[model samples]
Target chain A: MFFNISRYLGRFKLVGCVVRNFLILLVGLVFSVNALANPNLGLPPLNIPADNPQTAEKIALGKRLFNDKHFSADGTISCASCHQEDKAFTDGLPVAVGINGQAGTRNTPTLINAAFFETLFLDGRASSLEAQVLGPMLNPIEHGLQDQQVIVDLIRQDRSYTEAFRKAFAIKVDEINISHVTKAIASFERTLISGDSLFDRHLFGRDHTALSSSAERGLTIFKNKGNCVTCHEISWNNALFTDNRFYNIGVGFKQLTPVLDKFIAFVRQGNNPDYFPLTAVQRSELGRFNVTKNLADIGKFKTPTLRNIALTAPYMHDGSMKTLEEVIDHYDIGGDQNRFIDSKIFPLHLTTQEKQDLVAFMQALTSSKSPNHPTGE
Target chain B: MFFNISRYLGRFKLVGCVVRNFLILLVGLVFSVNALANPNLGLPPLNIPADNPQTAEKIALGKRLFNDKHFSADGTISCASCHQEDKAFTDGLPVAVGINGQAGTRNTPTLINAAFFETLFLDGRASSLEAQVLGPMLNPIEHGLQDQQVIVDLIRQDRSYTEAFRKAFAIKVDEINISHVTKAIASFERTLISGDSLFDRHLFGRDHTALSSSAERGLTIFKNKGNCVTCHEISWNNALFTDNRFYNIGVGFKQLTPVLDKFIAFVRQGNNPDYFPLTAVQRSELGRFNVTKNLADIGKFKTPTLRNIALTAPYMHDGSMKTLEEVIDHYDIGGDQNRFIDSKIFPLHLTTQEKQDLVAFMQALTSSKSPNHPTGE
Candidate 1:
């Protein structure tokens, strides 16, 4: 009997060695295949969190959950309400609209390259994509959920979601929570990487003929004369086209000027989460100041990514400018002059053709697979 | 006899090992001590070329050579004529007045942080500081030397210079040449590092009380609204304040626009070093295009450092704007409109107070020891 037990143990040890080797190979294979090279966009790699590894099942569940209206206070709204896939994940609105036709103060920024952003939102409040999902879901003007439990309860009750949670997270039905939901949604959002553009082909691929001659000239103006490359960065290897820092380019500074003192006093008041409701206009105008409350940050808003900028219209933090030309014109005049305006916004004495060329160059930034990927582009 | 020879050789080998170890220790010690930290300026180590290392004797010799007027055709115009120490190493002239009062087309840029420049000169023609010394020395309108042989012959004849050269370079008097002269001058120029600005203290040293509240607000404008940080870069670790790239900010573009086609044709004719004499204005206006012959590079001039900007009067390539206010106004108006003007140049509608704040902030950038360092403040 002792001899038999010893032989069985030896067999088990051999099986264990084989299993360990297989796992090592599998990990190596996964890493080698998935080092985040989105060749189409010339992107480096997606920063996937360790805790929430992307599974096909998780991504599918996230996509379904992203579209599910049951997560909202009213059945009419979901995450997709404002971020429609057709408009490069934007609703093509000046500001986001919520349940019962409630309106948001700020313009809807596109989610094309949100994964690469250091901080989310025009005000740059959220530090991560996972955290940003909760902002709109709870905001009275957006998804309008009462609290975290509402989302968790909804997931637990749904049979499909329960199954999805089990498959994605290896959790029981009771374990379905807001954190898992956010993780899944963020995971889905991460896959929305788009890089293949005419400009990308011309620049990174060294396909000189990819860009139009006018676009090429426009690029020079954009880089040199326009000084746009300062805020919209393009490194030697990659071009996120955003410095990801805040600046007040004089968009809506005029309205805030008259009541600047009053607004400052209001924001200086002790921590109030519900400040957005009472001071929607003030909050929108305050921009980054609403977050940091630093005097230097007054009227500052995060520089949005110029990737797929053409599809998302009604530009600026307030959605004040309509066309790209108008936006250019505003910048040409060096933004509205205010005490707090960023000094960099000087008048660019660009001629009409040069302006058109700048527009052309920006147009070239549109990804070939964007404005609803795999369907609309 | 064999025993004696082997014993002697063994003794020599033991001495050689001690000598080699000592040499290694010496090199390691030199590197640790001279790793290029200028605490006052918070600058990184100066990039000393491997071929021409910095020595105290070499720097002193270069300083003497920098002030020596005999190098000019008429013993009046040394490097100091254009780059005067009292004027923050700038002539404080709208344009450089060369030998016999011949006016060059561009303003004399500051040499405060010039050692950090990737390329030398306003047009960025010179590849290195060593190469740059020849341009002004040989320029018929500037120092007006007939050839390199004249300077070499003059240096050989001078008793003090010959001895200084010997001490600095460890070369025989007969071995002295233009390259040695330039190397010495370049080495001296490299030591003109400045970082002890009030702004530097505040930004880099974490000394919040260093900057005035007005200057602090102005910094915000300079960073955000002015967008000047685009060309004048400030990294997290260091602030070179120059992107080292060229742009056409519409400074001399107006003069180039009418004659741009003719100018292109003239530059396209072929390599002509003497082109500067005949087409002085055209050469200056052509900017970076003269160096590369690339059509896109027209009207582009290297972004000069803003360090000690307050000391250097008559800003811009042409030096048309006399004061900081005038320079601000020119930028405010978007730099006199032109087809090739950098699109980044937009009308900055700065309030009078804001403009003053910007000036104050720039003034804060002046190193505490600048404007004739170790002498004037």
Candidate 2:
């Protein structure tokens, strides 16, 4: 699933720096099940909204629609474009490329355990999966759709979709609204939940042999001096590797420092934050501030799950780093001096061996049971 | 599956008539298998090229590559764009649209029983599926790639493609060539043979009740007064429903008649047939003339497979006929007067009942076994 992140960079001239926001999150599993080697433990029951309960028809229909590109303006670019099944559902680019190669600011975050996240997206602009699924389709530079009707119209064009819509939503194809479409896609995304990692086995299954010596040492460092378990929380009984909280760990925050003063002043003036004419990059760097007008939340981003950390490379909200080693190195130096940096991030003077061990431990967090596992494990 | 063919026209400002060629041929089945309901008759032994034999690994790799958009220049369209499985490999559009909404000049023919076809594409420009798979990737208006290396470079960028390529071809990632990619795709395509239609059951299994009364009457009309059996050859045994030949049915040729002399003179002066300056529409009308330099080949196109005629509509080269009724009516009028029209296409003077029966018979050509079957039977 490894793709050349650099190839995408120099292939086209910078298109005004529309960064893909790759905000990933993890919640310690919902259940305290005993099959820990099966990270399947601690997985909280999926939150199915009351209106849209899970059904086989909706999930199956959603899978088809997710892979279909006709819904896009140019009949190209589907949801699977940036969110590939392999690579833990993240396209391995520094930033995501959209319809007509519209580049965005941020990495594609893994949706492996997205079912547990409180909010959706790096900016937290969307609150639920149903709401989140349709946002990109309408974004001018994302799917480049003229209107939401583009999807509805496209869905109604094919009899298969018509039948599928009827079976899933109990509505005629033309009668299907954006809500039905998003609900179906959300159902499919819910099924992408991954569990049963090697680390989970070592911790919960009481399997002494599950973790390699290097990975075991990495796990210790992750919990102790590494300080990774705090935000990427590892509870006594479960390890989702994220506290599901927002933190500005100093990547894009430094870039926004210069723009911060004016942006905050604009927000104070009681104007809609989205009305600002910032470049996609600048808007993306706003992080949680866009969601909440609080000045203290300026550079905060959702703490992403590290469950499949090894597979999702070019890490962070901006996908600035290309490997786990680069990520560890960034954090090793406490990230580069940003004013709004989270207190959780600090310089850890780890040796080269310790870095390798930590990376190994993160690698061990990848689910072996998931079909779309990066290695196809 | 049903698509509103008329909706594409008159809905948008007519886009300069880049009609997709719809050259259909029916190959009578090569097999005489007794299990008419088995859905396996009429399928000829898959013609795996000696150079590119079928293997499980190759088929799997090809399937992935077939669905992958990365191979396209813009990372958008793939082979599946116009050849969706559900539409019997046709996109249900009158003409095929490619990347950037660039439309082509021929109806998407079904690949359901393509393994048994003698040549690939309406113009017969490609001799085999191996040759056909790569044609779209490089066509400026198709996949819109600048070079074949774009696909190769794209394939090597992903670890899954690299691993799959190695396992399928016994070649390392960097060592991969374009031939390996095409071979794999062709192998997968060879497996798209569909059979066991109600027609097959009625014909081969001696099941009189397999077809509706209307369909049975339509089958008689097809063989008798309709005169469809000549071009769409129906053998006593297998029902591939094609003679694997070329014909000019006077659809686009009537439009090209004025330009015919100039085109012929251009070819007479030793111009490359394929390099002729024509819009996608003009080039498509040239048809088999592009393959063979013979003057008689002007407007001639290969006879396409009719295994899933019902699923792939907006029938004929240029997709002029939206329904099977339109096709029957066209032959009823002996097509528009073109000097180059195939002698096989003659006016049938069919009654209203006969026309309805013919349409019903064509509908019965659909197979119930394919996963993507329109009926999902």
Query: Model 1 Cα displacement at B82 (Å)?
Result: 27
Give the residue spans of candidate 1 off by over 4 A. A1-39, A264-278, A371-377, B1-228, B231-377
- What TM-score, over all chains together, does every model reach? 0.52, 0.45
DockQ of 2: 0.00
Q: Model 2, range B1-377, lDDT digits (tens) per residue?
A: 11244345435554412221111111123233325346675454555789988899999988888888877767789899888988888889888888888888888788888888888888877889998988888888788988988888888888988999988988998799899989999999988878878787787667798889999998876754565754575543466677677778778776676677787788879987676667667877878877877676778887776777877888888888888777778878878867676545556668898899888888788887777566666
Off by over 4 Å in 2: A1-377, B1-37, B265-277, B372-375
DockQ of each: 0.09, 0.00
